[model samples]
Target: MSFPAELSAAAQAVEARLAAAIQALPDSRVRAAMAHGIHGGKGLRGYLVLESAALHDVPREAALNAAAAIEAMHAYSLVHDDLPAMDDDDLRRGRPTAHIAFDEATAILAGDALQALAFELCAQPEQPQAAALTLKLAQAAGAAGMVLGQALDIAAETAATPLSLQQITALQNGKTGALFNWACTAGPLMADADPAPLAAYAKALGLAFQITDDILDTEGNAETAGKRLQKDAEAGKATFVSLLGLEAARARAQDLITEACDALAPYGKKAESLRSAARFVISRDK
Candidate 1:
């Protein structure tokens, strides 16, 4: 399905900005790896960032910078996640994984460079308070948040047995939800929004998105999912479906989506796009 017109337009603008930023980088193997990871995909995380920004009345140009920053972090994570040390996948977004497209060493370097670029993009002086808010994004996507989540995920997969439902959810929250949370929170954070409500909305939507992702991984196809299918089960990774059964897991995802929408209600009609995006998260096939 297509995103809302505003979201789609914002995504296009963000993609253009990101491409320009990447092109300006020094030409090298690392830049090539970064480009490979960033060029494909639907730009879903970036869309989320822009949509959330619109919800808070952020200007389109400012929102585009935030979108680019979030996408950079996401692309970096995907490159690292596909490495041999991580998921060891051979394909991503219908193309060779970064480690396969480039050597593992180059892929690793690319991920690192992308991480730096994410912060750099955020720190750019164009937007007021961009530097401070970009640092916040770094902390959210770095060792304390997404990185820690990934460490737990890798351990869960390699352990003698799978993790419990709670453990798995926690891991997914950190690895996947942290970035989603950052995407939503970054816009509000940059705008100096009311901290309590902004964070509540971001956290709820982040978890909701991840639970829906678990559902899709179980039932989605490699072709449409843009990655391997049932790979979580093959890896013996604990998931909501594995613990709660498919139907129950689906129900829980729906509940989370409802909670996410509720959290945004206080934002009133301004949050319509964000509300729609939340529904799309749960309803998405991929």
Candidate 2:
């Protein structure tokens, strides 16, 4: 299948599963908001889960629930990230953000509920590796991972000086790379196979992904980006683009994409779509 097709397939599967899960919750404004939160985006994290699982010959059914789990967590993060106390954004996916569309209180509740549901899906996987998967999910989403990254980002805004390259790298690893790592490695974890190669791949891919995001923020159309852009520059925040210049940042992202593909050596041709996905990361408009 073409890379776009595969991504669509992954997104479709994950969305269906997520919809079903949200439908099971008791009806309320928060439940509606939860549905709203999971409504859109590229579904790259969920795609990673499905593709990695396919590489390991893990059954899709076994991994589909896990795929949905990560997407739910990602959605929750975005919802909270758009809150007034966070990025203070009023738009997401080219629409009113969760907090703006729903009441702030409802958005908060929806985010909280989505987060809880992510753990539930991971922990209740029909596969035998439920405990390990659950632990990994918590580690990625908890303070030591994504939350830690978000905290550092918030702190960076108030620091006397802008974040250095190394500091920003660390922050991106937590804020963005953590989930990418989990997504890329979940297949191997499910198969009880070694996750080292995928881990390496994800490390490079995550950084490249963030670097491209930095690039997009610099020159992307806000309408195309479906959210605010250039906020970093507006806030005087340091980014890969700010530190390295656009040409150098783009070069660095290309280098990392190559690194990401190289790390998939063990899977040989089986990883073609994954490689394509890496390439797509830098090329995406939004």
Candidate 3:
């Protein structure tokens, strides 16, 4: 199948699984909030999870659940990220953000509930190891990691002097790459594959994904991006593009993509989907 076709198929499968999970929620408001956050997004993280699992020959049914879990976590993060205490944006996916669409308290509760649901889905009967992997994801997304990065990001915006490139990269790795890494690495965990190499590949590809995002925000249109454009610079946030300039940042992203592909060498043809997904990271318009 072609890349776009494959991505669409994966997206559909993940969406179905996510919808089912959302329907099973006990509270109507929480379910509505979760669906609003998840139902119409780009599904990039879901695509990544599915592609990574496919790379290891995981069954489509199994991959769908994992993809759904990953996307649930991603949606939760975005909902929280747009809360008044975080990025404070009023728009996402070309619509009012969760906090704006609902109340701030509802949005916050939605984010928290979705996070718990992600782990709960992972722990479901079909995949016992998913429970352990979910713990890993929590560590990556929680206060010591993504949350810490976000805090630092807000601080950088308030600081008189800009953060160093190294510090900025660290923040990007935590805030953005950590979840991508989990999405990729979780595949191997679910498949009972040896995880060392997969973990390394995930780390490299995750950073590459963030670097490319930084580059895109500088060159992309707000309409295509589904959010405000140039807000990073306006907010005085540190980014690879801001630190290294577009050309150098693009080069760095390419280098990381190369490293990510190289890390998958041992998997041979099994890794092709992941390789293509990595290339897509830099090639995407939105």
Among the numbered candidates, top lDDT falls to 2
Pairs of residues at least 3 apart in sequence or in different chains that clash in candidate 1: none
Clashing pairs in 3: none
| lDDT per residue as tens, model 3, 38-130 | 867667778877776776677777777778888888889889989888788887888999888888988988889888878877777877376
Model 3 segments more than 4 A misplaced:
none
Q: What is the C-alpha lDDT of each candidate?
A: 0.80, 0.93, 0.80
Question: How do the residues 176-198 of candidate 2 rate in per-residue lDDT, one tens digit apiece?
Answer: 99999999999999999999999
**Cand. 2 TM to true fold:** 0.98
Tens-digit per-residue lDDT, 35-139, candidate 1: 888876667789877766766677877788888988888889989999987888998988899899889999999989888888888887777478677777877
Every model: Cα RMSD to truth: 1.8, 0.9, 1.7
What is the alpha-carbon lDDT for the whole of candidate 1?
0.80
Error of 2 at 174 (Å): 0.3
- For each predicted model, how many residue pairs clash, with residues at least 3 apart or on different chains? 0, 0, 0
